[model samples]
Target: MSTAIAATSEIRFVLDHVAQIGHLAQSERFAAASDDVIEAIIEGAATFATEVWAPLNHAGDTVGAKWTEQGVVLPDRYPEAYRAYVEGGWGTIGVPEEHGGQGLPFTLQTAVLELLGTANPGFALCPTLTVGAIEALVHHGTPEQQAKFLPQLATGAWTGTMNLTEPQAGSDVGALRAQAVPRGDGTWSIKGTKIFISFGDHDLADNIVHLVLARTPDAPAGTRGISLFLVPKFRLDKEGHLGAFNDVKVVSIEHKLGLHASPTCVLSFGDNDDCVGELIGPEHGGMRAMFTMMNNARLNVGLQGVQIGEAATRKAVTYALERVQSARSGATDRKPVRIADHPDVRRMLMRMAAQTQAARALVYYAAAQVDRTTLGDAAARERLEILTPLAKAHATDLGNEIASIGVQVHGGMGYVEETGAAQYFRDARITPIYEGTNGIQAADLVGRKLGMGNGSAFASLIADMRETSQTAALTELIDVCDETGRRLAGADADDRLAASYPFLTMLSVAVCGWLMEAQGRAASDDDLWQAKKATTAFYLNQIVPEALGLAAAARASSAELYAVDPALLLA
Candidate 1:
């Protein structure tokens, strides 16, 4: 079968089942948009991703981007593709209609973003950052700020960047030394160097708006003292047009392992006196404002995992079908068979499909939950927050595995640069690292999500899983779900409440399996349902066993990792 047909079949089956579970609407964010509109939006995104974006994948990896005195320059095709993105109304998918956006639900936007990331992640970074900036302005900026900036950002006239990282302040915001001094004219002057700022300086948009995090004098220690500011590349004139040079300068861009199309820049703000910035929210409430964007960004990052895995899996299938190899045992004919006929190859493909599908289920469910929280009853919002970290951490980790498996299935060809599988592998390497590392995500799961409201969130999750299991037709499936749910529910406070990193992988597999079973039953196509069933079987039979070991380790020690020192790990 053709790859498109196969993808359509699989996706149709998955969505058909997923739709049966409940209203899988994108989010309350798009409560105003009709179902037809939403469907159109999704179809458009899929076409663009598979056609427009997919073709550029190798080009981006091969040619990458170049930096010069003017700014970061992308491939020639990038401008036209980006223009298509904006002209198609993609840049404003989820923003409010009042701000020149389509005002779709965040869930639908999540899907669209996934497609964009999958098609060409390097190209997607600029828009992603822009959307986050628009969100921040909408939530916290003064009315003038929103009215002035949101429209341009929505229209793709301006792009956005977040300057939160420094050489020393990557994971720990407390270590930030960037400064925002009061100018007494209401605007502040920001001075600091930001590293690894994606799209920090790019020529794709007319102007770049940076949402910078900096410390003010007399502010308290650590993250609490930080403030957020809007620093633009050029000052705006009375007519609200771009004018005059801003002090922000792109010192250099990183030569990274992957994502060559997107420039990760080292930006120096206020190196000259011209860098004027407007404060966002309260002076000391920058972290809070940043969170408003980070929450959405984190979920978006989770979807990237799903997108990358989906792309890699699709590529693997194409390679497996096209390449003929040795026959399986007992084949009487001398003709070679497709490598897919081999048990190991079949096993690998099955594993990749299952993991990708499971990760999709988890993240999509999270997306639906996020949307429901906005438009549905109060309980859903609480549920979504609880599951958000799970989606981000679990999906990304699975993405890493899927990418690795994709390379493995390609064998030696996957390791070489020519196969294009290596690009997916290299691109996927960063998803788990950004939007908070998987380690941080797990810690969030254990430290915050599990114990919130005296275990009410996780308690609700367990109860819901049990309810689903009770209704399940297959006793074995129900037994697996029930047992895992019970273990989750009955654990002591320490077990439930301790550090979440080590235990996150196990928790994810069980929950993912539970969700997949729900998805399988809800499916409409027999073949798709069968596939879902097989995937669930794999999860239960193979993946869930790892949970027991993880749980055991999690319960055993807080410092077991230290038992083997750095010296021993060196080999």
Candidate 2:
């Protein structure tokens, strides 16, 4: 059986044909990124991912991260793998040129990230957070802050993290109690404990640049009063030299169900009352600044789903081809054949293939829109806003579902960890929960994104989907869009909120269907293209029709949901 995680040809096909990434290369912003250069970069990334990171995935999962008095200790291979990643300049691909980066298109970076996540998601988390931190600083940081942090972060000399969640606040940023007291000097003394801080402490880099959310002493209550702070693990002097410890410590690391190699730390700031931090943006502007990072992280997390699904699908296909099973119903020979020949097995495999490909197309398309925004397309920016939550929620949900099916494909052996199929399922389970839960994403789609410009953005998106083609799936999508628009327009906030999840799900399915159909129409006569066409057909015929039921559920009233008594549910 093949050990390959993803096919390079397929990635190239999607980039060129489905996402139309050439337009990015032609843009003045990314004029230096030619087709040859992009191809070479992708090939190099694939080599590093498959050769270096892929080998450590199982070991990292098994050994996980250990905590001692000193700090969180990762598996031995982690440091070496991360070092290779940095040395190869993988972290600088999408950063701006002024920051000592390669300045490639974000769409290209997204492609490379898919490879990294597939190879080892646990390892991928470190750089993923760093990239988000880089983005936040590039957009919102002061000149001094950018000068001090961007080079190190872009080159992976030091890693980065976002500190948001606290014991009192999980998803509700308004409830956080972290305090930032203004010191006599320009800096502020940060004091608080942050939970679920990914890569908060690690042995992989010289310092960890923590972008934390805290409240100022004179600020108002709730999220409106919060401010963003940049607190490094070690203090830096005027010359950008590392100085004394910043009084930030990791109290412990969480033993999680998956992505165990990535340390989720309980971080205490100013335990010794010496954790000084600089303001990232304006005072009382933390939410907006943090959203810049969170939005980027959300898109990356959504891609995580697609990555894991593709990896799991590859593994399942390989196993099915190797594992011997019963013959077909009208077999003349008594000997058993490969499980791939079985009808039920084929059904599962096709579902996995179609969903994974569809999710990839959806994510890559969104990334292209982000690139378009960089070229000053306001409409593309709005489209990205609407697509963000849908991509995150839908892709991650599919990742979990497809990984579960991968386990089933491996049958009894999949239950045993030695087969490696169980690992994909475990790793994918966290994508939907983190970077804002899928439930929150659904609500954001309904309550926020859909309502943008008095519902014009969503209406325009639906119109674009309708223009793609008039297949049954496309028609269903149009119907759902119209129905959702009507329901949301007529109902109060409560009714719309109740229908949010289903509406998001329905919308995602329709968008995926439209992209797949577009792929089908553009495919050539090549074998891979033919396979893509078949997968697109399967999605439209078998999978996409499910959106109709989702639309129905989304259009339903919230009365039944409210009718159930919470106390009686336990009985």
Best by lDDT: 2
lDDT of 1 at 247: 87
lDDT (Cα, tens digit) per residue for candidate 1, span 461-514? 766766665222233433443344345445654554453565676666666777
C-alpha RMSD for every candidate: 3.3, 1.1
- lDDT, residue 186, model 1: 95
lDDT of 2: 0.90
Q: Which pairs clash (backbone N, Cα, C closer than 3 Å) in model 2? A: none
Model 2 C-alpha lDDT per residue in residues 1-571, reported as the tens digit of each score? 4354567777887888767888788877898788898899889888999999999988889998888888888998789889999999999999999997988888888999999988888889999999999999999999999999999999898999999999988899899999999898889999999999999998989899999999999799999999999999999988999999999999999989999889999999999999999999999999999999999999999999988899999999999999998877798987899999999999999999999998898899898888899899999999999999988999999999999999999999999999989999999999999989999998888778887888888888888888766687668667777778666866788888889888888888888998888888888997768889899899988887877777767877888788989888999
Off by over 4 Å in 2: none
Task: List the candidates' TM-scores in order.
Answer: 0.91, 0.98
Off by over 4 Å in 1: 1-32, 470-499, 526-530, 568-571
Candidate 2 TM-score, true structure as reference:
0.98
- Candidate-wise lDDT, in order: 0.76, 0.90
Displacement of residue 20 (Cα, Å) in model 1 is 7.7
